[model samples]
Target chain A: MSRQLIIKGSLRRARFTLDLDLDVDLSKPLGILGATGAGKTTLLRVIAGLERDFSGRVEFCGEVWHDGDHFDRVPTHQRGLGVVFQDGRLLPGRTVESNLAFAQQRARNVNAAVSYEALTEALDLNHLLSEPAEVLSGGERQRVALARALLARPRLLLLDEPLAANDADHRQQLIGYLAEWLPAEGIPLVYVSHAAHELAQLTRQLIVLERGSVTAQGETHVLLEAQSEAIDSVARPVAAVVMSTDVEHSTATLQLDDDVAEAVLPGERVLLQRELTEDSGLGPALQPQSDENEG
Target chain B: MSGDLQAVWLTALLAATTTLLLVPLASPLAWWLARSTSPSRSVIEAVVAMPLVLPPTVLGFYLLVMLNPESAVGSLWIELTGDSLTFSFSGLVIASIIYSLPFMVQPLQAAFRAVPESVLEAAATLGAPPRDRWLNVVLPMAKRGYLTGCVLTFAHTVGEFGVVLMMGGNIPGETRVLSIAIYEHVETLNYDAAHVLALGLLGFSFLSLWLVYRYAGHRFEVVRG
Candidate 1:
């Protein structure tokens, strides 16, 4: 239960330096929302032990992995981090099954919560196992990559804009699939994305990064209202209540500021219910009673 | 006639030995050449490709001097094996390996270079060590380069005349390779025998190279360093 991640580091390069001092609770999924050059990917890489040119002390789950100058940093392979890069980064020469099996073979600890059978089935990769990784479509490759990373039984999963490479339809499908499965898996995740809606679909708590620094860190709804409005010019955040749900028709009725809007979407009713129902135990605490509603 | 056949067999043996030794020897060098960003990378690469730029006689001269009984390498060989390093089958193999070094390394380096870093990083994150990643991921992805390096090494060693002549003199059943035999045949005015040997070498070279270029060479043509 003590899944605390403390990172204090200063990564210096020729033209840029990212100084971070963060203490994040890793029991729930944490979203990292940032625009390009915000050092979102670099933060993930530093935690995953892929970027080592930084001076830092990182302690996760009460174990110190980096101690600034004296400690011998744990190498990337030994860090037990499941990283799903934005590019999918599947081994081109291996078949999809081989790629998964490669991770399975190296899994040091098999978390009972995440099994190979469940992951393969959940990712729907049974039929595409024999196909070469290079030949898979963008969506299929990401699925296989996600499955492969899970099969490694990592202690912490790091996803860097995984849906950025997919088409809109594939992105929606993937997001829905992740929204359903992420809470059930019980593995801590640091999901990095530039889109607020995409991160909102997975986690409510988020840290907003800007120019290699944290500008805001709190619940998604409040922080987005303050931070995102200043950065994003084209899109504004909207608040609405689900008025009614049509399960058979896969539709939902929302009351936004006295304006009624009906949306036809797949699984929209169920998604809205999950978002609104506090009984689900996975949804964030949404209280509209507080005047401040401060993050 | 029997001498010519023996020369043919010796040439095959020398080429085979050089190719077999160079595959493992050149692979690490090729990988380093392909991936290393160290300051010594250019220097190491120049040394590897020295055989291609320098005349064969120059290489032959240095190798001949180095293999002298009084030289360090020659003395080390003498201490280990109690035999001279020059004018022997072992000497021919060493000379051929050096003479055909670039042929083995250049193609393999290019192949290793073509492997994307992301794929290797994925392997690393999957708990594979550097050696395992090279063997499992890199070696398979660069299979064409390995094939090309092996074929070229074997063919180049078989066809070498200058370094073999200078370093491993025509000692029958010892260093008398096919090229040397052909040279002797021509010097002795045995045009008929020389024609046969020359034609055989020409035919084998063309076929092996044609087959490599037809199959694996296309992969190298587009993606090369």
Candidate 2:
């Protein structure tokens, strides 16, 4: 599974230049976390072969797509990648099924891991098949976009701030859904986000981009555990735990993950355990964790 | 009444022919005017709008001269088609197409311009080529502008008298369109016939336009380019 993408390029937009030097191996979901104007989307555009004025070399899965020295630049359509823009750019005139079908037609290079049926079922889009894309809710549109990207069978999936349009509940569900799906299918993704708090639950690989360059690249868990100099140069520490909840704020317990977890108290709760031991299955599913200790 | 009916049918025929010529030519020109950021964009835009600024006679004069089989463009076209573009119904169509080009394009370009780049990119990302992107995404999204361009081209061609007089030379049933017939009626002091023809033109214009835009989605009004 040597599905990896290595990109080094510089693209000039009106007053600023986006310079990226990155190596993203297709092993797990890769997160490019940064603030607005960090050139995160610009870098994604270069990867998708949309921005042509870029100078660099890009190799995906041992295939060279760009070699700057010889004036080799692949056009965006030929690059064989999938991209999810921040705008959830759905086709307004197309039905949800047609939108998904369009992606299926284009993704010649991708392996068909997720069927359109599975996508509609997982994203709960069965009722939306005939409706125009413009009529969908924001969350529905976002999910449809994600489903469309997956159906394209892309070797590398690029998602830019997909959760920005979602509310708290939708975001939480989507995070859990992506975590369960992206890893299980072994599909590699480059998800851009400004919030480290959001990226933590997704993957451990974090690359911090600033101004127009990479300031730090490491595992998210490692980066979250310790604030590095390169990261601190452009950002301050964000409060995070391997698994902590402010259950004390409302005195409600909820089960989140299962690795090595005991029940937790309201304040210092780490990972939630599966044993609230109430009568209904909802107790365990909705049970909150309580912990009294930490490192 | 029979005379008025004949003239009305003649105008409708001219309008239909003009619209037929507008579609293929207008689409490419309108797209270039709407989307291209190249250095030639302003030049193309100016060329498309030339008929709007130039006097109808001057445009008609140049067109007459250009289609005379003596000029290079005319000679080439004449050699290719074996028929020179002068005083013929086809010639009238060609002249009317040029005169109404800007009317066809301004609306269409505005429509194409209103389509978001995000949608185009989304189609590209989904594997549609540029041609497919235009046909599937661009055309469908800009349906209103296309409809407007068609209507305007037809209306402009129907009222076209000056260009037809200069280039077409007003031969009955060949180039003596309803507008020219009305002009002839006025010159002969036939106010009743002129009034009949003019009213017919007005009614048909209003009715045809109504048929096209009357049932258009109310949403189209506020959001249209």
Candidate 3:
């Protein structure tokens, strides 16, 4: 459908300079993969027109969103965008319902694929609706933020770790929901995450960034497989399958191949390997294939 | 109305007018002071805050020099409205606005600063334009600031004396405010009338400050600059 998002710019920060010149097709939802301080968030900020210091051209779907000059540029609000910041950034001193209402009120008048009731239900936000946004946990806040962004009915969706704060079950559920909803609605998406499995399931094309520059770019699975092999060579890894998840306790029971089951804690790092399953309605199930150097 | 009654009415009118006018005028200036990173921001802030530290007579002296009928702004006002800018109600309104500017701006600045930039960016990405963001997001978050600014401005204008005496010079039913009336009563040794007006002012000041603290929950500092 020729949905092109072109960004040719350089933004300088105190830590590092983010320089990029790329023309990406948004038809296959794009994913930006990078480590911390790798300019993933900065790149998303540039595309959303949040970085006013960015100098160059940003054109989307034949529209000139930015063109180097500070005065002459399409502002972020005018660009028909739905951006979910990493922190959620819900309006303070307001309820979750009010925050959602804020987006719904200003939503573009188009053929919306998802209704308010449906989105709230899908995100499991009916209980948290009356709660003030300030009192929400990180996971609850992200769910509300994701719902709010979808409610905006944006032409382009930019999500920066929209589900990172969520527990494994909710994260998988939302990723599955978005992987389906975005395509059905034909909304071009630019998702940023450091999780390889997330990018594999949600996005088709991937751009890996390192130190504010694109280090690798290709089809999602192909690059991920190559990256996995490279990591496998360095560290001998053990394969494990998630048997059950305790969302309340933020722990997951992983059954290793030798029949040894270990309950992994919340903040533990585990490498997720995508396993293709035909019967699993939710896309590919992310099997926790390895704990780094635990073999 | 009696002389004292007229003075009271005039004082209320002046305070109301100054408060209403300063709300719009100080909003943009305060917003700028809250957000801008320009080198000149401090200079502009200092100028806006001059009335808080400078003696009212010093400000009144400069205002008198600048707004006398012979001065450019005074002559322009005379030409436009057929009235002198000195010893007039209009003159008092202008002087009061300047005298109460810091009262309005400082509270609003602090309030605007309290609003996180991330929230504003979130509002923008939600399809709200600049005006919509300002009205819905900024205004609601800064309501306490508006409350503080309005109460302080109104109370400060009501208590104006030195500036009014120097510039607007106690013209009955024109510029004769409560403070000026009290001064006249004391000068004439009418201690009863002076006592009545003085006590009213003291009560009003205390009440205004109390309202600021009670409702706005602000520290109610006069030396915010």
Q: Which sequence of candidate numbers ranks them by DockQ, best first? A: 3, 2, 1
What lDDT does each candidate get? 0.79, 0.74, 0.86
Per-model TM-score versus the true fold: 0.84, 0.81, 0.89
lDDT by residue for model 1 (A1-295), tens: 7889989988988777778999999887899987678899989888877676879888889888787754487677777878899888998767888888888888878764757777777677888888878788877888888988878877888999887656556667778877877777777889998656677778778998888888889987777666533333333335655566554444456566778766543323223323233212212221231112211
Q: Give the winner by TM-score: 1 or 3.
A: 3
How well is each residue in B38-65 modelled by candidate 3, as lDDT tens digits? 9999999999999999999999999999
For candidate 2, report its TM-score. 0.81
Please give the RMSD to the true structure for each candidate, in Å.
8.5, 8.7, 6.5
Tens-digit per-residue lDDT, A1-295, candidate 2: 6877898878777877888778777686788866578889988887777776778887788878777753566556666667888878988778888888788877776556566777788777898888778888777888889888888777677889887666555666777777887876677788897545567787768887887788889898787545433333434222222245433232233333443332322111221221122111223223222333222
Better of 1 and 3 by DockQ: 3
DockQ for candidate 2, C-alpha atoms: 0.30
Return the top candidate by TM-score: 3
1 against 2, candidate with superior DockQ:
2
TM-score of chain B of each: 0.93, 0.87, 0.96
Ranking by TM-score: 3, 1, 2
Q: Give candidate 1 regions above 4 Å deviation.
A: A68-71, A114-117, A228-295, B217-225
- Candidate 1 similarity to native, TM-score: 0.84
**For model 1, which pairs clash?**
none
- Tell me the deviation in Å of residue A49 in model 1: 1.6
Using TM-score as the yardstick, the better of models 1 and 2 is: 1
Per-residue lDDT of A230 in model 2: 32
